[model samples]
Target: MAFGQGNGLQRQVISTLDNQGRDVMGLDTLAWKYPDSSIVSGSLLTVESNHFCVLKSRGAVLDVYETGQHQIITPDKPILGNIVQGFFGGNSPWQYEAIYVQRSKLLAQNKGIATSKEMAIMEYTVDYYVHVDTKDDAVKLITHMPFAGERIPMAELTAYAGPVIEQAINQIVQVTPMEQINERIHDIIELAKGHLSEFLDIYGVHLNDVKVLIMPQDARMRELISLRAFGMSELEAVRMYLALKMADMGLVSAPNAAAGTPFQIGSSTLGTFDVGATAGLPK
Candidate 1:
């Protein structure tokens, strides 16, 4: 707690020291807000290392303070100082919100579904790292991202970035052939990292790293892709795949010849196979 003397009234001192304990405990706390908005002139604003303070009012970011102690009405910070001086007496308190934003890196793992160039549906998971790297970034985060509680947690940051990461993955997969996706996984991750970095720039966040893992959702597609990844030609891979027939228990779905049913083999559809009527197979 900090205090100041102005106009025979006590001005409040504010800092994130009260909440720093939670931050140090790996809570992933992103930003903490001072509970009261009635800020007084000449009050001390303490900004700790690896964090910055965003001064805002009426939903607008008025000023940003870096790692240092700032007198609320200092001459160097005209935007906030002027705003405070305009309405209240030189030494009176005014309404302003102070948001302290942390600079710690955040890691998030997100999964999404997308279709490849061959129209094979794929499911992918991306692990990414990001952080607010500058005062401008801190301002951008506070201005662009929504905050409802006393603080913003890392989970919310991940939630905001999940769709962006998935969108980047979709863009990459939509143009990559299924047969080549496995071989180009490293290239895909690099492209996704670049795309996510560029996408987060507008929000003042810097992406540090990204890892993506993609595989087709269809069982047959997964098998085919896995087989093809072993330097096998498409025909060789398909020929190597065995369609097992079960007698008691196996992966067999023999179509009923009486009903003339059709079944899928690999990527092809085959007509019904006729078995003798006395075969005694389940219909």
Candidate 2:
């Protein structure tokens, strides 16, 4: 499964083996489309979970878990677009306005810009606008428009966009079925509990407060705890756990709790132990 936002919309493509084991591809055409978009290229495969992996050249790979549900296996990193220089030859104000609106919306959706300050930069800068399409047969035209002296770096643009994207995601997650939401919540809590335990042991924070800080009425937290209780691997539990936590904390949001990178514990390793011992018998 590869998901992306481009040309002011979102797109999802699913690839699977056909009945005879040949590759089959499916897509949602209503999603965004970018002409000349660079293909994800690479070869190394990284396993994200039982249901997902990262393919070298492709983006994330999802494991089919239940009907209409998939475990996402991808990083939370933003994809950068190649910059090209070009001019739109036209004299029509309406066409220019359309192009500007489309470009601005695409940038906002993809880059995740949210702050008033950031938006101002985008709105006041010629560098951000680049060109305006005028007529159907204007051919090509170039002019030495004065540099507007204002620009947002690509990195800054991505940072600005991240939280906005997250907020949009949370809105969607809020409407997901309670059963699935709870499962993911439990998974996250369990991972956080483990991390809290370790952090307490190492830095000497009290266990009582750790529990309180990580426990609440959040459905995603509950699911993480359940995953831990069920003997899921620590890494698996943690990844699902973190994704949900980030979602809850308003850091990033995905369609479901299973989307995004696994939790990254600095130095903990999984051990073969009774789930009861590590997770504490389910409450």
Candidate 3:
């Protein structure tokens, strides 16, 4: 029962198939013929038979010795990290450093014998945080936080936040036909409001779970809500609003909004707000 950590409690059988569809099962025989490829350390090499060989690495297996028809098998390794390269420093991380050292020691103990793939997976938890030059760099580098990981630093947080901010800005400014831009601005505001409401619903600590009567009409309060909703600075929201307004007035369209302007819906604030403002128009 060969088992690897993170893969949970399950047994796996590594067997090779010969041309006649016979199972060739012997670790010693496999190791003798198909010496592990040195290009990648900790790769699994198994002899399917005298004529065929299989190599397994990461969670994937490949039959390279079969020239005309090669069989590639992708195994399900439960403990494998989702964002392997990006999470760990591309391919290597310090957390895995200890594993490598331990593996070396084991090999030395066994007089430089090849270790199993399952052993490699357990020896090191693919370090997703390796490429981070500094604590700040780490925050920026992390795309999705693991189930229970530590918080990233402020500088990295800023780096991560910058692109999303830019994207939001671009969405606001690049509206064709000034009228359409104004409508988008209103949409953005509404979206911000909606997000805030959702946030409050999720974690608002009311008096013993009693609902807090927070008014949505208050300007500063609304701004705060918007900031939290979009996770952007107040200044960014303001800039987005202004850009949308500029688009509404038939001013120069932002570069991203070069496409034809969309139809505008009449605002409630506009005089005699009517649903029929542009109704019955062809799509």
Compared with the true structure, all predictions reach lDDT values of 0.68, 0.28, 0.28
Clashing pairs in 1: 2-13
Candidate 3 — what's its lDDT?
0.28
User: lDDT: which is higher, 1 or 2?
Assistant: 1
> How many angstroms is residue 21 displaced in model 1 relative to the true structure, after the best TM-score fit?
3.4
Candidates in order, TM-scores: namely 0.64, 0.17, 0.16
**Candidate that scores best on TM-score:** 1
**Per-model tally of clashing residue pairs:** 1, 29, 6
Model 2 C-alpha lDDT per residue in residues 1-283, reported as the tens digit of each score: 2322222212222223234543221211101111212322221122111112112222222221221223233332133222111121211111100000011111211322111211221111101111112221111111111112221233333343344333442333344443343345444334434543343232111222211111224455456657777776665676566555546767423212343222233564333223223221111
Model 1 C-alpha lDDT versus the unseen true structure: 0.68
Per-residue C-alpha lDDT of model 3 across residues 1-283, encoded as one tens digit per residue: 2211111112222223344554333221112111112122222323222323324354233323332233222332332344444565334321110000000000000001111222211010100111112222222222232211222222332243334333432343344332233335445434333433333222110111111111232354444445445765555554444444446766553211222233344542222212222222212
> What are the runs in model 2 whose C-alpha is more than 4 Å off?
1-150, 175-274, 277-283
Could you say which candidate leads in lDDT? 1
Q: How does model 2 score by TM-score?
A: 0.17
RMSD to the hidden true structure, all candidates: 8.7, 26.3, 24.7
